[model samples]
Target: MIIASEKKRVFIYKDTQLSDPSINLSKEAVLNFYANTYPELNNATIDGPEIKDTELHYKFLSTLGTKG
Candidate 1:
Protein backbone atom coordinates (compact mmCIF):
# COMPACT_ATOMS: atom_id res chain seq x y z
CA MET A 1 0.00 0.00 0.00
CA ILE A 2 1.16 3.57 -0.71
CA ILE A 3 0.98 6.42 1.76
CA ALA A 4 1.14 10.16 1.25
CA SER A 5 4.32 11.81 2.52
CA GLU A 6 3.22 15.36 3.07
CA LYS A 7 0.18 17.46 2.30
CA LYS A 8 0.52 20.12 -0.43
CA ARG A 9 0.49 23.70 0.83
CA VAL A 10 -0.73 26.79 -1.01
CA PHE A 11 -0.58 30.41 0.08
CA ILE A 12 -2.97 32.98 -1.32
CA TYR A 13 -1.79 36.56 -1.63
CA LYS A 14 -3.60 39.34 -3.41
CA ASP A 15 -5.71 36.83 -5.31
CA THR A 16 -2.51 35.07 -6.43
CA GLN A 17 -1.78 31.54 -5.30
CA LEU A 18 1.78 30.87 -4.12
CA SER A 19 2.93 27.32 -3.55
CA ASP A 20 6.70 27.04 -3.14
CA PRO A 21 7.65 26.50 0.45
CA SER A 22 9.20 23.69 2.45
CA ILE A 23 6.66 21.53 4.21
CA ASN A 24 8.99 21.40 7.21
CA LEU A 25 8.25 25.02 7.95
CA SER A 26 5.30 25.84 10.14
CA LYS A 27 2.39 27.94 8.87
CA GLU A 28 3.80 31.05 10.52
CA ALA A 29 7.26 30.41 9.11
CA VAL A 30 5.90 30.10 5.62
CA LEU A 31 4.21 33.46 5.96
CA ASN A 32 7.41 35.09 7.22
CA PHE A 33 9.41 33.70 4.32
CA TYR A 34 7.06 35.26 1.80
CA ALA A 35 6.93 38.51 3.76
CA ASN A 36 10.21 39.50 2.13
CA THR A 37 8.71 39.36 -1.32
CA TYR A 38 5.35 40.74 -0.23
CA PRO A 39 5.98 43.35 2.45
CA GLU A 40 2.25 43.81 2.77
CA LEU A 41 2.15 40.41 4.39
CA ASN A 42 3.84 41.91 7.43
CA ASN A 43 0.57 43.38 8.52
CA ALA A 44 -1.50 40.55 7.16
CA THR A 45 -3.18 37.76 9.08
CA ILE A 46 -3.31 34.04 8.41
CA ASP A 47 -6.71 32.79 7.35
CA GLY A 48 -7.17 29.07 7.17
CA PRO A 49 -5.71 25.67 6.50
CA GLU A 50 -8.81 24.70 4.57
CA ILE A 51 -8.32 21.20 3.28
CA LYS A 52 -9.23 20.46 -0.30
CA ASP A 53 -8.42 17.35 -2.29
CA THR A 54 -5.83 16.38 0.34
CA GLU A 55 -4.08 19.73 -0.14
CA LEU A 56 -3.56 22.32 2.60
CA HIS A 57 -4.54 25.87 1.67
CA TYR A 58 -3.61 29.08 3.50
CA LYS A 59 -4.54 32.67 2.81
CA PHE A 60 -2.69 35.81 3.92
CA LEU A 61 -5.35 38.31 4.70
CA SER A 62 -4.04 41.86 4.39
CA THR A 63 -4.82 44.11 7.31
CA LEU A 64 -4.53 47.22 5.24
CA GLY A 65 -7.80 48.50 3.92
CA THR A 66 -9.08 51.69 2.33
CA LYS A 67 -10.92 54.10 4.61
CA GLY A 68 -13.87 55.42 2.69
Candidate 2:
Protein backbone atom coordinates (compact mmCIF):
# COMPACT_ATOMS: atom_id res chain seq x y z
CA MET A 1 0.00 0.00 0.00
CA ILE A 2 0.98 3.61 -0.51
CA ILE A 3 0.03 7.04 0.73
CA ALA A 4 -2.11 7.80 -2.29
CA SER A 5 -2.82 11.40 -1.33
CA GLU A 6 -1.94 14.13 1.13
CA LYS A 7 -3.30 13.71 4.64
CA LYS A 8 -6.67 15.24 5.40
CA ARG A 9 -6.51 16.51 8.99
CA VAL A 10 -9.49 16.75 11.30
CA PHE A 11 -9.15 18.62 14.55
CA ILE A 12 -10.38 16.76 17.62
CA TYR A 13 -11.06 18.37 20.96
CA LYS A 14 -12.57 17.41 24.28
CA ASP A 15 -14.08 20.18 26.35
CA THR A 16 -13.29 18.43 29.64
CA GLN A 17 -9.74 17.96 30.93
CA LEU A 18 -10.33 14.29 31.64
CA SER A 19 -10.22 13.51 27.94
CA ASP A 20 -7.07 12.50 26.17
CA PRO A 21 -4.66 15.07 24.80
CA SER A 22 -5.28 15.95 21.20
CA ILE A 23 -2.74 16.85 18.54
CA ASN A 24 -2.52 16.94 14.78
CA LEU A 25 0.22 14.42 14.06
CA SER A 26 1.46 13.79 10.57
CA LYS A 27 0.84 10.44 8.91
CA GLU A 28 4.57 9.83 8.68
CA ALA A 29 4.92 10.27 12.42
CA VAL A 30 2.18 7.78 13.12
CA LEU A 31 3.65 5.30 10.66
CA ASN A 32 7.06 5.66 12.25
CA PHE A 33 5.52 4.89 15.63
CA TYR A 34 3.96 1.67 14.39
CA ALA A 35 7.15 0.72 12.58
CA ASN A 36 9.12 1.18 15.79
CA THR A 37 6.54 -0.56 17.97
CA TYR A 38 6.46 -3.64 15.78
CA PRO A 39 9.83 -4.08 14.09
CA GLU A 40 8.45 -6.65 11.67
CA LEU A 41 6.28 -4.00 10.01
CA ASN A 42 9.27 -2.10 8.67
CA ASN A 43 7.79 -1.22 5.28
CA ALA A 44 4.26 0.01 5.79
CA THR A 45 2.01 3.04 5.37
CA ILE A 46 -1.07 4.23 7.23
CA ASP A 47 -4.49 5.08 5.89
CA GLY A 48 -7.50 6.77 7.43
CA PRO A 49 -7.83 8.50 10.78
CA GLU A 50 -10.72 6.44 12.04
CA ILE A 51 -11.79 8.15 15.22
CA LYS A 52 -13.17 6.02 17.99
CA ASP A 53 -14.07 7.47 21.37
CA THR A 54 -11.17 9.84 22.14
CA GLU A 55 -8.66 7.95 20.02
CA LEU A 56 -7.55 7.95 16.40
CA HIS A 57 -6.71 4.81 14.48
CA TYR A 58 -5.34 4.00 11.05
CA LYS A 59 -5.22 1.14 8.66
CA PHE A 60 -1.63 -0.09 8.65
CA LEU A 61 -0.84 -1.87 5.43
CA SER A 62 2.50 -3.26 4.32
CA THR A 63 4.03 -1.72 1.20
CA LEU A 64 4.18 -4.10 -1.72
CA GLY A 65 6.12 -1.87 -4.14
CA THR A 66 2.93 -0.21 -5.37
CA LYS A 67 2.87 3.49 -6.34
CA GLY A 68 0.35 5.72 -4.64
Candidate 3:
Protein backbone atom coordinates (compact mmCIF):
# COMPACT_ATOMS: atom_id res chain seq x y z
CA MET A 1 0.00 0.00 0.00
CA ILE A 2 1.15 3.54 -0.80
CA ILE A 3 -0.08 6.86 0.43
CA ALA A 4 1.01 10.49 0.10
CA SER A 5 0.27 13.45 2.38
CA GLU A 6 -0.88 16.73 0.95
CA LYS A 7 1.12 19.90 1.43
CA LYS A 8 -0.14 22.48 3.93
CA ARG A 9 0.37 26.23 4.00
CA VAL A 10 -0.46 29.00 6.48
CA PHE A 11 -0.65 32.78 6.07
CA ILE A 12 -0.46 35.28 8.90
CA TYR A 13 -1.71 38.85 8.53
CA LYS A 14 -0.23 41.23 11.05
CA ASP A 15 -0.41 44.71 9.52
CA THR A 16 -1.82 45.01 6.03
CA GLN A 17 -3.84 47.95 7.48
CA LEU A 18 -6.99 46.69 5.84
CA SER A 19 -10.06 47.40 7.92
CA ASP A 20 -11.24 44.02 6.74
CA PRO A 21 -9.78 41.22 4.69
CA SER A 22 -10.47 40.58 1.05
CA ILE A 23 -9.32 37.05 0.50
CA ASN A 24 -8.30 35.09 -2.60
CA LEU A 25 -11.19 35.66 -4.98
CA SER A 26 -10.67 38.51 -7.40
CA LYS A 27 -13.14 40.04 -9.85
CA GLU A 28 -12.20 37.82 -12.77
CA ALA A 29 -12.10 34.70 -10.65
CA VAL A 30 -15.53 35.39 -9.16
CA LEU A 31 -17.01 36.18 -12.56
CA ASN A 32 -15.61 32.91 -13.85
CA PHE A 33 -17.18 30.99 -11.00
CA TYR A 34 -20.50 32.75 -11.49
CA ALA A 35 -20.53 32.27 -15.26
CA ASN A 36 -19.36 28.70 -15.34
CA THR A 37 -20.66 26.88 -12.31
CA TYR A 38 -22.88 28.76 -9.84
CA PRO A 39 -25.97 29.94 -11.66
CA GLU A 40 -28.04 29.84 -8.49
CA LEU A 41 -26.38 33.06 -7.33
CA ASN A 42 -28.89 34.89 -9.56
CA ASN A 43 -26.22 36.84 -11.41
CA ALA A 44 -24.96 38.55 -8.29
CA THR A 45 -21.92 40.78 -8.49
CA ILE A 46 -18.64 39.70 -6.93
CA ASP A 47 -18.65 41.88 -3.86
CA GLY A 48 -16.35 41.09 -0.96
CA PRO A 49 -17.65 39.25 2.06
CA GLU A 50 -19.44 40.76 5.00
CA ILE A 51 -18.91 39.94 8.66
CA LYS A 52 -21.40 40.67 11.42
CA ASP A 53 -20.53 41.16 15.05
CA THR A 54 -22.92 39.23 17.29
CA GLU A 55 -23.01 38.90 21.04
CA LEU A 56 -23.23 35.47 22.64
CA HIS A 57 -24.41 34.76 26.18
CA TYR A 58 -23.71 31.51 27.93
CA LYS A 59 -24.46 30.18 31.41
CA PHE A 60 -22.16 27.75 33.16
CA LEU A 61 -23.84 25.07 35.19
CA SER A 62 -22.16 24.20 38.46
CA THR A 63 -22.02 20.64 39.73
CA LEU A 64 -23.66 21.94 42.94
CA GLY A 65 -26.98 22.21 41.04
CA THR A 66 -26.65 25.94 40.52
CA LYS A 67 -26.27 28.03 37.39
CA GLY A 68 -23.15 30.11 37.36
Best by lDDT: 1
Tens-digit lDDT track of model 1 for 1-68: 99857778898887899985887888889889999999988888998989988788899988987768
> For every model shown, what is its TM-score relative to the native structure?
0.80, 0.41, 0.22
Model 2: worst 10 consecutive residues (lDDT sum)? 12-21
Off by over 4 Å in 3: 1-25, 40-42, 52-68
Query: Of the candidates numbered 2 and 3, which has the greater TM-score value?
Result: 2
Candidate 3, residue 63: lDDT = 25
For model 2, the stretches where C-alpha displacement exceeds 4 angstroms are: 1-22, 50-56, 64-68
Local error of candidate 1 at 28, Å?
Answer: 0.7
RMSD of 1: 2.9
Per-residue accuracy of model 2 over 5-66 as CA lDDT, tens digit each: 43344322122111122345466665565556555447866565786664555565665565
Better of 1 and 3 by lDDT: 1
Best-matching candidate per TM-score: 1
lDDT (10s digit) by residue, model 3, range 1-68: 89865322121112211221123654344344443433433334333232323311111111223358
lDDT of 2: 0.49
Relative to the true structure, candidate 2 reaches a TM of 0.41
C-alpha positional error of residue 9 in candidate 2 after TM-score superposition, expressed in Å: 9.9
